[model samples]
Target: MADFVKGLFGGQQPAKVAIPGDDDFADYAGAPEPTPAAISSYTDAAHLAQPTGALTARPYTAWYRVWERTSPEDFKLEMYILPFLFVLILVHVWGTRANRSKAKAWSKAHAPLLQQEFAQVGFREGEATSDDILREKKADEYSTYATGRQNVAFIDFKITLIKRFNPFMLLGEYLIPLFFESIPAPAERVEATAYVFDGNEAKHAPQYGSGDAKKVSNSSFDGFVFAIVHKDIMKRMREDRYDISLTTTRDHAKLPVWTAVMSESAEITDMMLTPELIKAIHDAGDSFEALIVTDQPIDQPKTLDDTKPKKRINLSLKLESTYTATLPLFQLFLRLPDHLATAAHFRPEALRRIKQTRDEQISKIRKLDDDEKAEERKVAADKQKRELRDQKLGRLSAEEQRKFLEKERERDSKKKMKRSTVKG
Candidate 1:
């Protein structure tokens, strides 16, 4: 105890004193004293141990031996990754090829029907190539288009198909519909048609309207057409809301319910919607989405200053079922341009009013363009003046800059006075 206390406080070293059971405790704990041979074996076996002396070169077979001894469980997940990716890629390629085959078959089947109507028919199979995408903005991989006749400016018939083996589509089309009854399953196929014809007398700006067929009680007005014209056109046609002159109640009694008429007078409507056309509408039923006679541009211009687009009559329809029987309806629409030009003759008064409306729209567009240009010029002029003033100030001394600012203020005041005097 005295020696332990002296060791803590005093500088002198104390004599060593071992515990009585220290050797027995070490033996019971099973920790043997390390030997020179045992230490040398441990150092040689450890692959990661640093050399105390010079570094020695290891044989290449040593690395191979270490790799062979590694557990297979270490790389179980990585082994499956490449094979799974290859299978996914193969499925995508098969789906794409199948889609193209279906499109080709559809085009082959429908080519004969188009040939019957057109003198020179051309069929082009749809592709998702970069060139096709660049040529047509709305290019689809699964769609095929046919062009017929020279008079017909454009014809686009698109058939959209479900992407085969697509996981996302499988989830939406099958699994989601099973869980949610209200959510309808996606259609396997959908078809849409657009026909554009060049016309000589279609001078109106963009105008749009839509209507549907409805049954009425009266025999005379069995399929009463409920027409809704564009709001702007409606406003111009009728000055007072209370007035019944432009009302659909009397004007569209003979036409199908929900058929839109864009004309100020009913003369154009009566000329276009003949008995045959009405019969076709009734016959086509719900399959017929619309048979529009529009002169609007298919693609809108970026600027009002762009050259006026050509005038044409456009007919658009969307059908869920096959449109083989609807070929006659297409022919009817094809003949509409000639029917309006030759068969239907408008009154001189009506022609003058229509021309006037077109001229007004042209003038309005021109005014807007001019205003935009004037604003741009004004901004440019202001910027130029600011830059010149800045340059001048940069060249001038502090005192000179002060005098220059004063002179500028005086010139502005004089200009304001001159403008006021002119007004007075």
Candidate 2:
């Protein structure tokens, strides 16, 4: 009892009794030894007691710390990329605003001149409010100019002020200058006007050259203004399909040296360029680019079936200023079609020849179109045949597929044999 009390109070230890065959207990054990306590689920009490500083830390400061640890090359790349993107955005914004301001100013300046010519003078297609102009952000929308319609005989008159600050042109204009100063920067803006009118009675397309006499004569002729006729007409001319040439030389003595004509014949050229008209052209000075009378489409046709294009008289001019001095030239251009109808009429013989040439050209084009359609139909039929064969093969067994292929081969052989016999 004394020993038990001492042990309970933790002052004395109890001795263990020795058992016989203790080493042999493992041999007698039926169950496997219990697994050590799993470390995966274990947690330290000390660690749990420690403070977590994440809640009080600043996010931006943490991010900065991560960036500070980046490699030198990576840091340099980041610096360059960030600044470039910022500059690009700034340039785009500035350019857009500059273009808009210039367009608005031009519209205001030209409003009076346009109002005088037309009953309705407004933005392209129809009238637009200040809000509408501000909202237009696209490059194409900016390119389109102000228009005037509801004139006496004219279809529409347009005045376009080309944008000076173009983001697309920035690379060539600004960056290229740094490397090669010798390369001159092209003109940024062009103030141009176009007067359009129907010329249904025009027998043949006629184009006249403009600008300084020496320059006009010496410069190589290219562009739509020079070639008023269709590609078909040009092609035929190249092939020597006609007896007369398309180029009709003007009388330099009677007309200005700058006035060069490309027409169907001398008769049409003579009729088109009268003394009064020549005087008007001469007065217009170097501002004139071309006076085109064409029956061909200005824009490309959407389909092959759209063969017949409308006839029109197109007068292009470069206006240096918003001054009303060029108003008389505009007036003369407007009355040109009327003048042609009343004062100048083509002889019956000349009209007959022009009509005949046009009809022949149309016939040839139609034939080519019919041939293309035939080829398309043939290709479509072949495609359908292939699809049907594929479907039939997909449904068939392996043996049936082999039999079908053999039959096809036999049919093809028979066709070849029949062709050879016919040729013999």
Each candidate's lDDT (Cα)? 0.50, 0.52
TM-score of each: 0.51, 0.51
Give RMSD to native, each candidate: 16.6, 13.6
- List model 2 lDDT by residue over 188-216, tens digit each: 33223343323311222122222332232
Tens digit per residue, CA lDDT, model 1, 130-219? 223112212123443444333343455555555564656655687787897555455444343434333311221121111211221111
Error of 2 at 54 (Å): 18
Q: Which stretches of candidate 1 lie over 4 Å from their true place?
A: 1-109, 123-150, 169-265, 298-309, 319-321, 351-353, 380-401, 409-424
Q: Output the lDDT of residue 144, model 2.
A: 30
Error of 1 at 146 (Å): 5.0
Instruction: Assess the local accuracy of residue 260 in candidate 1 as a C-alpha lDDT between 0 and 100.
Output: 42
- Per-residue error (Å), model 1, residue 121: 2.4
On the 0 to 100 scale, the lDDT of residue 395 in model 2 is: 100
